[model samples]
Target: MNQDIELLAAYWTIAGDIYPMGPTEVSPFSFENRMEAAGQAGFKGIGLVHNGMMDTVDKIGYPAMTAILEKNGIKHVELEFLVDWYLSGERRRQSDKVRQELLEAAEALGARSIKIGPGIGQEIADVKLMAKEFRLLCQQAAEVGTNVVLEIMPFSNVRNIETALAIVERADQPNGGLLLDIWHLERGGIKFSEISKIPARFIKSIELNDAHKYAIEPLWMDTIHKRVLPGDGTFDVPAFIKAVQAAGYEGPWGLEVLSDTHRKLPLEQMANRAYESTISQFRK
Candidate 1:
């Protein structure tokens, strides 16, 4: 049922993008406020940034967050992006530990998938090496009953759908799949045809964030710093959604807007605007 409907919500990271005026992304918003606002805004659910539940996930742990979500009727947390990709040595060990934490969070919070970026930079120069690395990640993810959603970010080595899919194919595990972000789609210059041709099996999870034209800089800065609402800019997002449907994707199509401008208003207003804009785009 990827096609026959519409679902949307404003990401807290967008709140992070906009900061203070956005969605109380840092401190003061509080869990009570966030859930209350989201419930009132007519959203299906939220795509949580793990850090948002810092008090619960970090301090009190997963079950507390799950109880909170269950108590509020917010059972659809789609993606959990674990952002500590570039760690090595003790930090690498910590990465695995943190990953376990995420899985626990998922089981506790009812998260469907966990997003994983395989670090950054030139280490991915060799395709085979990254593929093996991905397999290891998948094995770990499977243990926690969470599929590892491999995010193909512009700044990372597998910056496009093709490369990410290739790595997934080589990794040869059921738990490994693609997480498509539109900013990555355009920045990586991944063609629509390529996106359409991706096998149904590869795209386990997906994300929708939009962008305005960029002046060109490092890929790292672009993925986070320059994203807009899905339909507000030039991403051909509806067509992209159609491509996902055309390829048989049946997963959450969550909005991940990162506009610095949009966050100035109340988050409920922002969420409504994002939800309405995205729903309108898919109307055709």
Candidate 2:
């Protein structure tokens, strides 16, 4: 089963020594090291955050980064977490700047997709406006020969499949789709059966991770510091995987563990555990 499926090491999973929301979000490890660890752990692809990508591109350039990826047998690269896309004023301007950088990186790296989402802890009053803005983003991504995948979070305005699907339906772009994370879906209280109802084309990607059945208070804390390996927590990882597969999702499964404990492990150990634990779910 592991041989048949490709696993992607999401940025947070192997992001060495980075504070997620702190002033500095760059990983201390070199890009080559991260790729090497993931590749050695049997991952076919890897993810990078915006700041990390910028730092690497500035330090060694895209050609060097590309060479390292080729050296590691990484076929798929996922770039992520673009927010403030649907807003206006200074925020929208800043969002546009980041969006351009991500698109450029995606085109240069031949990345599989760029992950985006609505703002966390904020709700948009108009879904149609969000759709309009998302359509533009998708069009830009398509021009670069990549797709834009939307991740739904409980803290975001579009928290459930129903709302997420509505936005994607309205956007109506083939490359504009949903990123269904097992942690988010389960934490948000969305049913596994809801995934069965989504059209395959709309299910662009999926993430794997597990957590306690009940989230800790101030949910964001739990997501960042309490996530466990795929089968280590109470999540029904197998069922979620089955639902996504049933919906015809054929892309790599993103392993996005963000626990404090996971981050403390040695690079090789973290990568190994992430790959081995998630792959075991498929065998089950």
Candidate 3:
């Protein structure tokens, strides 16, 4: 394994349930099994979603869960998918509860960051208001000793590098930054040149995935079910890697292939392939 790369087994890589779309009916791998496979496959980190984290802790104690990850040699942890923070009323309150739990879990698991994003849609919110909310979220996360990273998605409000960077700048919290995913960058039409311009400190993390040059129909469905392995698609992954390295991002790099087909593989096979495919990019 390349010590500099710190490959992460992203949540969707092994998650049994795909949500909204239902279960993938893949390998019925348990959390411990996933961690063990990841470690054996040379992954240094593993991502945990909010529901997964809660369920894992409930089924096994937090200490026991931590022990399993430690025994598997997992170092970095990532928790994700907080939404509705920009809304007011009951929706925001519900989201806040989930966010609080996620932040607490991140602190407990020593996760690098909690990924947050706006709901998927074309509607854009007031950047200032978004910044204000982001600032408060960062402060809250800071209290738990975790970072809050805003993810830019093609269908989300923060749909481009510029908008994501702007919100992070306005928030101005050291613990608040951007979670740049290669898929989103490509689908959102963000140039690698723009990514190179971001200051290192503002890029909290980077996730790698590949897809066709032209988007599949119903982009959201395709994103959830059709992402290819890092080197198997049309993405200029080597260039993306070089750009981030040039920008001075030294954080963990995650393999976030969210494909239904991928979820059906045996645990070890999935982990090994994900790690191998991702590291091949850095080698180039």
Candidate 4:
């Protein structure tokens, strides 16, 4: 393993023109624009999320997008995905196909990992069930020469670093890993005191963002609502970064923010803000 820690610039959904689009105003910073911006910003890589995949891919074919990533010297892209289609039920084949699509996407984009937000339901947290299912996914990911990184989201069944590690432990595969997003860490009810307990080996990546005390009218009426920028909000992002550092996690860092207000401002400016906020927190 390289063991090098670098940051991957993400455009959650540079194309979503609707409700859950990213916080930063959608910029002309399309695939091409991101490539142009990467070197100047010192973004070691790109964390590509579906927060706009549905619309973005529809507008531009995956093959085309992948080509763009390659031309830009981007070595990998971490995809945001729903991983429920891979269970031992009616949708098993459907699930397999989805995983294959991810594999294909990796092949196209030359990505290293896919961020798997495993579906949660009554049986999702079942120890044995999640293990079996995750193991299968890991096997598939290995075959594709890619990694499966479980992302911890607010209201998630595996909503914290602890739960994420537990599930990965059960999976027991080298390709299995976890993603740490600060927004989810803050909202998922995890405190810094719990950091030492989280295993360092499984931390595949870390996400960055800050928030405020007063909540915005729920991003939607749902539990996984919206979020603000790194410095604009009230969350203690610097402390969170320090905790991750103490935990011995050395991996790619992602500057992620899900906001509409951000989008209205210049995308380049928002990206600069994210870059600045991340540096300030990492130093703290």
Candidate 5:
């Protein structure tokens, strides 16, 4: 694969979301199968959710799981979906357990980052306290040779690029940074002009997905099941790409389409479409 396309990643959702019922009557393929399809489609990296990674390890052993990725020529691995780190008491404790396991898994797999967010509600906590908690998480991640990237969701505490940047700056950990997902970027009303203001060092990762210019009713549902492939919707993907590139953020661009429609496709078709659609944006 060429260097540019080699920087493209296929996220786990491109395979399936690990639903018990599967993405469709025929889907929800195994982790090994997903990796092989993604590799064959020219993706150099693959994303894994925390629970999915643990389940795969339980089934195949960590060594075998990593071996599958290696055989597929997958170089970058990302673990995701850590939540409630900003809460206290039982919630924080529960988050800690999952966080620890994900950290260890990331270390084991030499993952690029652990994707985390405040989840689907508005957070009213003190920004400083949030930064402190994030700093602690970054320290833990640092010890394991991984990065902790805060994903900004429209309904979450870190709801915009400005807020996400504030938390990252206050945390002041080298490994603590922001994960910019294009769907969330548009949903949060952040313009590409604003994205250009961020330094490349603080932009830890970039995930690509497309959605309508106007939000659908009950936003979360659309986010989970309706995201379109790059260039298939109203998002100004080429502008977004140009803005990030202008900011000097040179990293793997992750294809993170979480649509029910996408999941229903056969693995090879899904992977190929994701790779082609994403690469088409860069071509523009």
Candidate 6:
């Protein structure tokens, strides 16, 4: 294994005994257990979903959470899924509430980044206004010493690398950047060569996962339930890893394997498989 290529187990990758897109989104496994499993699997970091993280923080407090992370050798923390950040009215109000919670947790835990995006299937009517809002959001995050990473999904309005690049470029904050997921990039038909066009500063984070050559109908369902581990499917994950590395992104690579089959595995197995498979791609 290349010790230099550290992996951050994305929330869903090791979220054992959870029904994704179901009524309950939080993991059944405790935070301490999650940290232990991730650490033992050789992960240097772990991503946490907002609701689950808030519940854990409320129960144990940020200090306790940080202690667990430190004890388990988890260095990088990613707090995520803040959507509706670019909208107005009641939607924006609700988003602000979640944003406040996520930002506070981020600052308290010294998290590396907070992920955000406009909701899937909700098209942006005013790209300029959205860019302005993203800039402001990034400014607020920068105040707390973290970066705000926007995930570009095929189901979302900022659906491709080009449109996502434009928003980040316009947002213009050093802490504002994009989250490039291999599943999204390949499923959305984005070429690997496009990775070169993005400046190093704009590539805030990268996620590694694989899938069948063809996407299932209603693409979101395919991503949520069918994603395979890196190198387990048709995606050229090794090439993708090299592309990102060549693009100058040195941050921890995220292993975001979201699948129903994966969620049913033992926590240790889930974490280990995710780490081993992703790290193997680097060796290629």
CA lDDT of each prediction against the hidden true structure: 0.66, 0.90, 0.85, 0.65, 0.81, 0.90
Q: Native-vs-model 6 lDDT?
A: 0.90
- Candidate 6's error at 156, in angstroms? 1.1
Worst 10 residues of 2 by lDDT: 16-25
The C-alpha stretches of model 3 lying farther than 4 A from their native spots are: 17-27
Worst 10 residues of 3 by lDDT: 19-28
TM-score of each: 0.84, 0.98, 0.95, 0.81, 0.93, 0.97
Give the per-residue Cα lDDT of candidate 4 at 159.
Answer: 64
Superposition TM-score, candidate 1 onto the true structure: 0.84
Rank all candidate structures by their lDDT, best first, as comma-separated numbers.
Answer: 2, 6, 3, 5, 1, 4
Candidate 4 per-residue lDDT, tens place, 86-129, comes to: 46665677666667777767666667788777555322466577
Per-model RMSD to reference: 3.5, 1.0, 1.9, 4.1, 2.6, 1.2
Per-residue C-alpha lDDT of model 1 across residues 192-231, encoded as one tens digit per residue: 6787767888888666767767634765555555666777
lDDT of 6 at 72: 98
Q: Candidate 6's residue-wise lDDT over 177-235, tens digit each?
A: 99999998899889898999999999998899999888789888898889999988999
Q: How many residue pairs clash in each candidate?
A: 1, 0, 0, 12, 0, 0
Tens digits of per-residue lDDT for model 2, 93-200: 998999999999999999999999777998653689989999999999999999999998998888988888899999999999999998888888899999987899
Which pairs, if any, clash in model 6? none
TM-score of 2: 0.98
Model 3 error, position 91 (Å): 1.1
User: Candidate 4 regions off by >4 Å?
Assistant: 1-5, 13-29, 50-67, 86-94, 120-124, 216-225
Minimal lDDT window, size 10, model 1 = 13-22
- Clashes by residue pair, model 5: none
Poorly placed runs, candidate 2 (over 4 Å): none
Kindly report the root-mean-square deviation of model 2 from the true structure over all alpha carbons.
1.0
